[model samples]
Target: METALIEYGNFLVAGVTVNATESTDFAAVWDELLERVSDEQKTATAKLQKVGVLMPDAADEGFTYTAGFIVQGIPAVAALGLTGVVVPAAMYATVLVEGPAADSIKPGFEYLHSTFIPEKDVTPTGVNLEVYGPGDVTASNYRMYCWSAVDGVESPI
Candidate 1:
């Protein structure tokens, strides 16, 4: 996976959050979230995109992940029984992954952390963002953007 360094503005998102450990079933977590947050909620947004925000724990054991929708402004998140997040504006090392989500996401992430960041001499902020399209995710050729926020870019493309 090749990475491109790009800057993005702050994004407002609201959805259900989960404390994800190694044992957590991500598919089930996403399923439950999608169940509670309707299609209307997910689509009625400023940016028509769904995102998975991963914030690593202080000890690096697990992550607090939010399955969310990019919204326009202050939303009534509590009324919908959801949590809101303001993804800060920053420079990101991004990779476009195309394949089954199960087969692609983890390996792409590993490549970024273990190879790209280290080789490029960039410092990770420990915030990873997954931008998903409104398509058949279970399909073999699902597409998504995986972004890792970094402090500095050794080389920007």
Candidate 2:
């Protein structure tokens, strides 16, 4: 329900992603992700999301995306065997997602991409972010911040 221009520093994430353009249940993807995370994982942030956008006119069945925690290094999470992705510093149109990790998470991104981005007249960098709190997936007390990668997008909302 809030909007702002936020800056993030580089961090490592070992996780997964789905081409949002494809027909997929994003919530289930996150559930599968939870199983892959190592028990000893250390996170730089409570939670975060990273996505790669495909270029227009690009040849592909779907777009590219990545999701995971903010970690110190890829080696730190090498045990998980997940492909590591580094989130770089950039300004993003950020929004907060409330409720359960399995439920609140997906829609948060949807709001930013479907409503926030276009409303701002800004092109998504294709690097999306989601911030999560301590614990596993559920419908209890969980918080996540969904961020859209954007460059110099101004908002009046």
Ten-residue segment with the worst summed lDDT in candidate 1? 39-48
Can you tell me which runs of candidate 2 are displaced by over 4 Å?
Answer: 17-21, 37-61, 118-121, 135-137, 153-157
| Candidate 1 segments whose C-alpha is farther than 4 A from its true place | 39-47, 57-62, 76-79, 154-157
What TM-scores do the predictions have?
A: 0.83, 0.65
The lDDT of model 2 is 0.62
For candidate 1, report its TM-score. Answer: 0.83
Clashes of 1: 0
Candidate 2, 25-128: lDDT as tens digits: 66566556766765554343234443332222235444555555555676745766666766666678788777886677568778888888788787777666
Colliding residue pairs in candidate 2: 47-131, 47-132, 48-130, 49-129, 49-130, 51-128
Candidate 1 lDDT over residue span 1-157, tens digit each: 6578888889877777788875777777677777886667655543457788888865788778888777667646654566788888888888888887877888878888898878868899978988886577778888888899998764344
